[model samples]
Target: MSQMTLEKRFGQSTVFVASTLMENGGVPESATPESLLKEAIHVISCGYEDKTDWGNEIGWIYGSVTEDILTGFKMHARGWRSIYCMPKRPAFKGSAPINLSDRLNQVLRWALGSVEILLSRHCPIWYGYSGRLKWLERFAYINTTIYPITAIPLLAYCTLPAVCLLTGKFIIPQISNIASIWFISLFLSIFATGILEMRWSGVGIDEWWRNEQFWVIGGVSAHLFAVFQGLLKVLAGIDTNFTVTSKASDEDGDFTELYMFKWTTLLIPPTTLLIINLVGVVAGISYAINSGYQSWGPLFGKLFFAFWVIIHLYPFLKGLMGRQNRTPTIVVVWAVLLASIFSLLWVRVDPFTTKVTGPDVTQCGINC
Candidate 1:
């Protein structure tokens, strides 16, 4: 169930009208639920009798998970300023999804909702009320709303390294090159900053690492699917139904009954990526050995990324193979399709021509 609380500061000004208000002639017979909601806010902001407080009139409406944030965005776009509060002592607490499938569905719903708002006329960037928003606020809203779109670029980044490894194609600069140093430095800087931010947010190192693991898992499974679903809804006029997260059960410890086959589709991308990376790692090691360890540095880089993918995907792999966790047949089909596409890319790139020429021994006689 959805819940909300009006802050003490806004309590007196905010009016909560009942059906009785209509009988008393306070609200019109023709007033709709939407109109009544608007009127309540208006009356509160405008005040009744001698009291008129126009500028400070702000309203908040809570909808289902799929609509709540959208409602907030629409309201903000109508020249209203709102702050999202996360009190030190939580004002409200709710159960979250305890399993992977339910968690993914929750994330997908959020991503789809944000995409819907971003595509709508109420989009903060181009909407009429956009001018009323501060520049910083506008940027922040835009960033938040367009989060789903990042999945596309993220997908490419995640897959491209594995693809390169499979095809014996190197995108990273040579170890001896200045660009390599810069690239390594930049990656470490971003990683370190992420750790610092996580620490600042009161997360421990283990928790932060676990969060990153889930970040990869959720990005591939939920985020990518949501982006595609959102685009299909917007472009093809397809309707995407929302799935409510499963509530925690106190009486029964087992919640597996709440799990559905629909979630099995999400396993495809991560599973396929894992398989490809595993194959790439094996092939990379073989090629490095065959080349008399001439390309150990580049092979090591490829294997490192492949290992990263494997680490994040270990749980998914286990689930796929587990008899108790038996995945849907459709997941197998999707995995095969993904593998075929990868194989085509590998063949097209022609891994045979990718011989690594060891560095000139004379360039560093003693060091060599």
Candidate 2:
């Protein structure tokens, strides 16, 4: 089905470069008119000469990392249908980043680019040309364009629990109840579905789990950083350069911790989050002990949240502790700054004074 869609929509025959076809004997000289030759040259050099031209029918375009998806969105907005082809064996294979820092930088650039496209006049959702696009096509492009926006909420969720713990507050309900059960079930269902989707896409369980960890770490840190840079470009009229990821290979297959000074800033957010979570867990446990474990319910929630943060922080922690070179000096500075800020908040800001109460917990039995 996908092959047929690819053939019907984006078959190579539909895109004709007169010079190439003539040189390769794909199209005969007799068939190539002089006017068509001119148009072909124009299309090759600059994109779509006219919106109504044959070149406009081309559904997808591949260029630089940042421009590729933007081009696809533009074409789709112009009512051309396209599909991504992920073959078992790639049609083209290239070097991939072997280290987390490089990978995060690559995603940051993509996020910034996608955000730019989303906010542009050519945004798929609000563009005049978008009227011709089908609802699903428009939705797909919308999803692609706004994907980086998730970083905002994701960052909040990742840090909120630690903040609450520091302030001696519980955001989650205390007693196990119907609503909590429902929430737990929903979370499990979503997680299971994600695992299934990854498995179906030929990802191993370990790889999928590692990818999720990266998602949390990178999504909150690098993605949010990209959003900030992207906003400066879009709203402040600043120009940002596109970043290319390093494709350096590791000599051994095992993970190696190397100090990439350029990306040390990217480590700040995750490192700060790790420190906060560690502090929160230790403080929460001490507080619980002092309270005769009466605060076990809230303590449990804090511990669970800390556990989740630790899972995502595992790689970063490993890198930090591995060797002197593995831990960047800038990261330590950032961590210390964050710790001081958190300490001030804990002492003077008084987050606990204006405590936000949780949902009313209803007692429930095992069957209920």
Candidate 3:
């Protein structure tokens, strides 16, 4: 019964509404329980339209997993406006996922939904151009759907420092004096924005920092997975299962659930990322120690970026560790296995050494 309610709420609401609307030519003026049952029976036999037109034109848009966002986008495209309101008293409250695993799963569902909309035909980037969607409004919608794509660049940004440290090649180009000023200005501006928001909104610095941490954690893990999942569904007709996040149980009052780990494929990317960054930090420090003070400057730059990634993932790392022996053995094995492979690959590649000519090439008359 709960499953039926969930399907009706999130997945099948469009179908239900469409069935009634199309059958009655609009909402009926009056109805009885008997008539309702008959209508239900009729709908059960006759399916609803799957396309954007017809039934979906009225209720929640049905093509994507995120019907709420799609519905709002469609409404806005037709010139409907929305206003933000803050009441003096609390208007609504609900249970939220408190555990690390549940929280990550919740984030994964949202990211997956956003990815679905992004790849769908109703994507705000290309769709709604013919409608009355204002430029700013359209841009906002575009940002909502497009944000999952940022995981790609975020992952790269997180990985590049480690790669540079391992290879002994600081390939990142140095900017000019003018560019340096611009870079510093941009960094300061971000700090200023955070400061102003905290000051005006009465939000704590710790809360602000936690938000930043979760952004990186979710980006590298859930959002990254969502992108690939979305691509697979779109290109190969493969579908991802929609797993609802588990709600906090009564025992969660002590927050013991917060440390509990659950095995999920979503854990793989972030775990691998964490291991690589840690390895990078160790390898970088070792390299700097062996090379002496002359190498310290470049090492500082590399370490700064690598440490930044590590700091953002600290909370996630803590969750993985859990309390005492409660941590899952599977997670430990996978993380260690991946870390070992990465370390071995870095050693075998030995990018710091110059290539030596083979004896066969040296013996050849012509240059090989």
Highest TM-score model number: 3
| Clash-forming residue pairs, model 3 | none
lDDT of 3 at 181: 92
* TM-score quality measure for candidate 2: 0.75
- Which one wins on lDDT? 3
Worst 10 residues of 1 by lDDT: 1-10
The CA lDDT at 308 in model 1 is 74
Candidate that beats the other on lDDT, 1 or 2, i.e. the better one: 2
Q: Please give, for residues 1-368, the per-residue lDDT of candidate 3 as tens digits.
A: 36454345323443345443453344444655677776667545435434324344545676777779999999899766677756779678777888777787788788888989988888898998889999999899899999999999998898777787777777457789999899899999999999999998878999999999999999988899889999999999999887778787665675666666677767777788888888888888998899888999988888888889899999888877657875577777787798778767876887767998666855875775
State the displacement of the C-alpha of residue 61, model 2, in Å, after optimal TM-score superposition.
7.6
- Each model's TM-score? 0.70, 0.75, 0.77
Q: What are the lDDT scores of the predictions, listed in order? A: 0.68, 0.71, 0.78
Candidate 1, residues 1-368, lDDT tens digits: the string is: 11122323233322333332333324445567887677577555634322222223334333324566655555565555665567899988877766667777788888777787777766767865534666777787788778778777767777766777777777464467687778899999999999789877878888877787777877887888888887788899887888677767666566654443345467778878876777777777888888886799777777777787788777667656655556777777788788778868776867557567776888878787
Model 1, residue 200: displacement in angstroms? 3.2
Model 3 residue runs over 4 Å out of place are 1-58, 195-202, 249-256, 350-368
Model 1 TM-score relative to the real fold: 0.70
TM-score of candidate 3 relative to the true fold = 0.77
